[model samples]
Target: MPARPPERTAADLLTTFGAAPHQTPRQPPTSAKRGRVNRPTAPLRGHARPGHGWSPVLAPLPVYQASTREIGGLFPLLVASPMPAVGARIGYDVQSGGAFYCHPVEWVLRNGLATNPNIAMFGEPGRGKSSTVVAFALRMLNFGVRTLISGDVKGEYTPVVRALGATPIELGAGNHARVNALDLGPLTARWDTWTVRRQRDELSSVLGRWVQLLAALAESQRHPPSVSDEAALAAVLRRLVGASDGYTRLRPITIPDVHRELASPDPQLWRDLRYESRHDFLHQLRPMTDALANLISGALAGMFDAPTTVAIDWDAPVQSMDLSRLRSRGDTAVAVALTCLGAWSSLATGLRDDGDIRIVVRDECWRQLRLGPRAVAAIDAELRLSRLEKIIQILVLHKLSDLYSVGATGSQAVAIAKDLIALCSTRVLFGQSTRVADDLADALALTGPEHQRLTGPVNERRGRALWKTENHPAHLVQTVLSSFEKRLFDTNAQLRPTAGRGGGVGRSRG
Candidate 1:
């Protein structure tokens, strides 16, 4: 029942116009008579001979990779629009024989951001995950694409980002440097500027309540006494905010008083108190906690006056979305700014024009995908349908286990790692010993040759990766930005020579 033209594919295109493929050629068929290739016979090739004549079923209209808007207006039919160029690569290392080697970080940037089909980067610490992100951000900046480099810690990339003339929007404070957080009222009034103002307010409140409760408990260094204690804590928060309003109606319960009244201890509730809550909360909290809140608020408020990117000037290179310096605040720092910035990037997709919008995420990405109440269906739906419509998600994470916390199944976090890898088109994995590298390779169903490239050689601080795609077979890549590369941009003002080509960092594994 499906219409003809038989769904043209990369293979079909290669066969048609002879797309040059990498690697050696396969043996030609014996019956296919060597040198000269046979051409299909056609009667009246130039002129109409039969009933259909020269119009002989040209081909069912294939969706020839045009913009959604362009396709609707028949741009593909005109054949005037050029295909997006894809040559950029992300590298990884893989093994071939007994010796270990490195490969180039490979990626073909075909403007995947405009449509769906996003990208992902998964690796472990010391694997150069953050370094890789920094290089990509630099590259995007070179392309004139504005970017936001956000993280819980102030970007170690600040020196380099600043060097690029990008503004550094540092959120949270570092050790010895305390930042006085803005209260909810001012924050709400401030944040009511973004397009998602109201919704963002609600989400932040949900996140803030949980975060504050945990903060209070952590402050007490003891278990919360009761639900009343939770209420009391809320009151204390209200009083501190100088609240004459109803929203800041939080009260405090003394820890010792509540602990004495405790009936049964809720271990899960206690644990949820702070080892962590939803990592996404960071985005919600950024406005309330950052010194940049008012600055960002003003920028957002001016948005109704101009373009979104221009309004916030948030995405530009000079505007480094910094989250470092908030050591004392703990996970809240990540929850407020870094996490929210990533979410905002995803939100910004489909809303931009002209330049490509690349959202670069680093550190514990697999862990971030881990969720509590959200639905996997929703996450997958967003990713497949609209998540990357206008923005490309450049996610870099640490471990395979971070993809899914032990029990959080059915949550939006489940199986998304797999979906991401499958649709990634480019999967550049770095150093992760254990079964993670092995399991990921197996999951992708990489061939023996592919496995060799992925598992070839890996180190703690730096390693290579191998990639697989629908069009291209498996290939290997190495971490492009090493620690030495990062130290070059460090503003600490200390200049040190990089480790020599022998690839030793202080001490190497014997």
Candidate 2:
């Protein structure tokens, strides 16, 4: 090895090549790290020297600053993913370009995305509010969730009900169908088998609902009942149901039966109500009695006074109560019919077997609120109980102002009606005029972008709506319906000239 040319070191080679060595010198390897490999160091940056490789210039990264609002627009999907396709596939998410699905119960119970299974839908006329609701109900049918249109004022749901192979129960002056406001429905079916405590609780609930219904009915006639009137009604309901006497069996009562009890002063009821005498009790509750009498004999005559004539097929995919006949009577008449149907439906759907979920649609629900605070209370109770009953109650309104119209400014009814907006965790807002859109934005705490989207020209198209589920970001959705669904949910058949000529629009089909 001819004097072993002093083995050249790595540093000597770097100096000979006119390249500077790394500033940090490598240390001798140790037995503990013998097999470890060293990572290469970054190349030095500077002007190139003779025989040295060129060092590329490095530029500083540009730091962009913008508000989240601006950034969200730039990267919408990155900001938030689309809502899971968990429920009924009603339409498409306009923002994320994904299919949109909604099942209020599933969203609340299974997904934990909502706190309640109630929804409030608002829209201007011809904006497809009704169509969207019908589409949701129809699609949810495939999920084994049934639907009940508590009060269909326009008979709009009739075609859907029939299409589902079930006849809708029609109620009005000339209609044969009857739904007693006091009918207990399925709630009291197992009363005898329940424990005493259960019976007492059930009785209290039954009486409370009856009294609330009676108060609303009385208010419809412009006679909002007094506190004493509610007490008398509760007492009478207890007596009629045999709950006051600790009886094992219960009795089913009708509106007329309640009216009869109120008309003929019951001595025991007067005593229970702490009245001095029958004459005093009769004189004090005169307005309530007169109101009940008017309901039995006036516009609502023969509609809700008799026993329930229509048998509800609980197992059916869908059921609707047609109240279009009363539309000719007046708004007030239709409202009273809605109040009665709401109460009847609440009782019918209250107690059901577990896993039996139903969607209850309250069309023109503002009319029910307009009755007075008591009526609003009745609706409020139903909304509150939705979670426990496994019911998804959908209230349809033409505008948010409809709720404010429930009573005078700052009135109790207005307060309750306004609070109704909070109870519904899901709110679907359709196309609105400039004024209505502004009010909706303020009421819902919608952002500037959300408000713009609501009144935007894009929302003007039919079936376009803004769906706000709880406190999550709102979704712009365009409801998609099949040709069959379009024909099935078309409510403008009467307005179309072709309909008069018996065109496909007017032709009845499932």
Candidate 3:
């Protein structure tokens, strides 16, 4: 029904559709730039949505906690580094968020805080004492420090020694690994060759150590040797040592040689002695000879009665004399063997450079102290000389009480043990029983805080300990071991799963 539209021309279509005509141009409409939409002055108000879940809540103003730094701003003394940055790191000083270091040789030398280079560490079994020592020894080894562990009581250090590519000398009744007390393997580097005086002094020291060991053995037998007996023994020792000189001295002197001299005194020496004196001397010699025979030809033969089959590897990082086998041998036998090993280790170090750092670790040291006052004196002397000899002695024991327990309460032996404890300038105290802690506090003169810390709960304190050094504040340290160290230094591997025992002290859970 609509009327028909006419066909549009090309010009009309181009003009209407906004195309430029053939000769004329068409212009486009100009537009102003659109402005940004302004936000509403007032926020869209419905339920007033919160920026975060807590924002819209009409709660009391949040009570912000003050930081430790803020709190210490009011108490200046409360802010300071808990540990000095020196020596090898052994632990963490949580108080100052710093690494704790305890290399006695370096710390003391740098701080001028100690006169002796010995360190004493005590803890209950499984409290991480052995692990800590092993970690320390490993670190020290990196510094070219040689460690000589005299008594590996449970073979706790055997693995570490082996890990360091060292050979541990296992001593027992018939192990064939003997350590002759008289073999002066190497003299200190100071002496290019042994001078007569040096040789005499070395022999005298060996003789003195032997006398103390023998006296201790006799004391353990309930028949302490008399002064006269010691005098006679000393005479015999001097004669044998004097007769053997030059290349002949190379022959290792054994306990049997001294016994042989006593059994058959030179005719001239016998005639020189009074008749009653001679009789008493022979009587005293009987017990000495019997004890000597037990060591050489009796049950305890072949270990110490001959030359040492194993020589100390001066280049080895660690040399541990494994005494785990000595357990079956009675306490006296073990003590005697340890004494000989210690003597050998000492002399071996003396044969090296005085400036060279050497570590002598005495584990289960209470066993040696039990020998007698004379034995305690010998140890005391060793501790005193450690500084000059460049020997850092690490004495590991159960607790300070072990020292006093060596002899009768309040006896001279007890006094000597106390003296020995005093000589150690640095001490590491791990978790101990309340009774032991109390005793240590008194013996060490620990402050109230230190005493409390030492008596902390067993579960919370395994690897945590209080470290004290001469003229330095005691620091509460948490021993930190690397994952690798944990696997090598752990002593409780038998009880813990492989990965479970990877952390040394702090990582060990209750």
Q: Order the candidates by lDDT, highest first — what do you get?
A: 2, 3, 1
| Cα lDDT, model 3, residue 352 | 73
lDDT scores for all predictions? 0.41, 0.82, 0.70
Candidate 2 lDDT, 344-387, residue by residue in tens: 88887886664688899998898877777888899999999988
Question: Candidate 2: lDDT over CA atoms?
Answer: 0.82
What stretches of model 3 exceed 4 Å from their correct place?
1-72, 75-78, 187-192, 243-251, 271-278, 297-299, 457-459, 496-510
What TM-score would candidate 3 get against the native? Answer: 0.77
Provide the lowest-lDDT 10-residue window in model 2. Answer: 54-63
**21-124: candidate 3 lDDT, tens digit per residue:** 45333332232432422422233452355542332322222332344444344345554653456666787874565788766777666657666779888888
| Number of the top-ranking candidate, with lDDT as the measure | 2
* Runs with alpha carbons beyond 4 Å of true place in candidate 2: 1-80, 109-112, 499-504, 507-510
Candidate 1 shows a clash count of 52
| Candidate 1 local lDDT, residue 504 | 28
- Give the per-residue lDDT digits (tens) of candidate 1, residues 154-253: 3566666556555555543322211112212223343434455554454345334433333322222223223444443343343333332433332222
